[model samples]
Target: MATLEDDEADIDPVKMILLDEEGEEKKLTTLDNGAAKPQMQKHYIRSIESTVAIRQLPSEGLSFQLWPAATTLVTLLDGYLSHLSESPLATTLTALSNGGDNGRKLKILELGSGTGLVGIAAAVTLGANVTVTDMPHVIPNLKFNVEANADVVARRGGTVDVAPLRWGEDDDMEVIGREFDLVLASDVVYHDHLYEPLIQTLRFLLNAGARGGEKKVFIMAHLRRWKKDSAFFKKARKLFDVEILHTDPPKEGSRIGVVVYAFVGKN
Candidate 1:
């Protein structure tokens, strides 16, 4: 088992390039409409063993900001790609399912994609086609980040698509119906109200794979915030075979521990 230290990465420091100066005229222009100025934060993701450069922002809401779990998952995924054939689950997650030799690309779907780091990592590192989704308000930022790294992903023989998906919505589920070989999520199970809805979404995605006779997998990295929020994991266990792939407290930043889990439908 590889420790988090083995896969640790960093976020680069923000540059001092300024877009505009804050002056009395700027304040007056904004105060005329009584609307608050937009605040956008820039971020750079630094990987230990990957060449991809990822930048993201909080375009709409708290849901659109980059989270620590995203960095952890991408680092872990980058590490896992080095030893793919060692684990059956990893092989299934990344291998081609055309009934021939393995070591081919995969189709991935990322739930609650937020700033699109993990999805981009899947595309750039694993050479997988990834669809990154989130709520409608967050789609703009998600698309921005995905497009920001378009060349890097393409250079690695992968592609990225951004979409809006609200969990437990039939229409949203239809937009992503049965198409992905793997599903990825990070830091999504925080709210207790989302427990059943998240489970329903997972069930829908896993059953899609079953209908196609392909063994699909859902991989998630969650940093537990409250004991009661474990309901999502508890609910997931009833529908899928849930296995913890990795667990480690954040080596830097806040002390939230990330636990990666692989889930497959029950037989």
Candidate 2:
């Protein structure tokens, strides 16, 4: 896992490079908005044969930047949609009928959707209707990225709606609703102070459909950077059955890579 400083180092680049379909690196054209130029990353979704462009406003804050774990989750989603037999997401998503032959498109809700990368990718890959949410202040950037990739998402028969959802806020949670088939997030568990709020949000979502005999799953991709991260998982385990779905190999200069986990309500 990369430390906060290491993640910050990634944002220092002045030129944002995007890959062409042929895999050649090309500089992304900067969009001047009377302020700092937004950093744009183009993630190629092979399943849809299209790319989703995500805009990051680094000047805003950490919530506006792309994170490592988000990229990992996007890759897994691409693999799953490609119907690759070896995709690590097969077991979990198949169980949820996310991209199965269920006839109905999967409905997903994403928490802490920084830059809206994973949510956008999921919509494109699975043709799922995804609601991407974040702090109220972050909603603008999320909407920007979602709109930027709207055509590509529509081509795949998917849609992405942006919303503001503060963690642990019951009113916000109620507004968003718990009718989703699955919940997704990446790089959400970090600050110790946020553990309880995130846990409360998870508890609210995971417990919603239990009485109706409907199983709602929360799949999170996390890169363990601090020893204290264990405390978040420990507390989460008390209410949800948490299980590892996949583990990415460590990236260069990192001791551990991103790990994907599935959390379901305890009976």
Model number with the top TM-score: 2
Candidate 1 residue-wise lDDT, 1-267, digit = tens: 943323334222221111112211112123345543444433232432445444333234447556667767776666666663344445555454453236556778999987787898888777778999988988877777777778788888999998888899999898788777788999797667888888889889988653248667888887665556555666777889988777765544434466778898987
Clash totals in order: 0, 0
Native-structure RMSD, model 1? 8.6
Please, what are the lDDT tens digits per residue for candidate 2 over residues 1-267? 643323422222222223343534444344466444567767777776788887767567678877778878888888887787475467778777734344888889999998899999989888899999999989988888999998888988999999999999999999998878899999897778999999999988888773246778899998766666777887888999987888888754555667888998998
TM-score of candidate 2 to 2 decimals = 0.84
Off by over 4 Å in 2: 1-36, 85-88, 98-102, 210-212
Query: The CA-based lDDT of model 2 is what?
Result: 0.79
Tally clashing residue pairs in candidate 2. Answer: 0
Overall local distance difference test of candidate 1: 0.68
Clashing pairs in 1: none
Candidate 2's displacement at residue 159, Å, is 1.1
- Point out where model 1 deviates above 4 Å: 1-59, 83-104, 210-212, 250-256
Q: After superposition, how far is residue 21 of candidate 2 from its true place, in Å?
A: 10
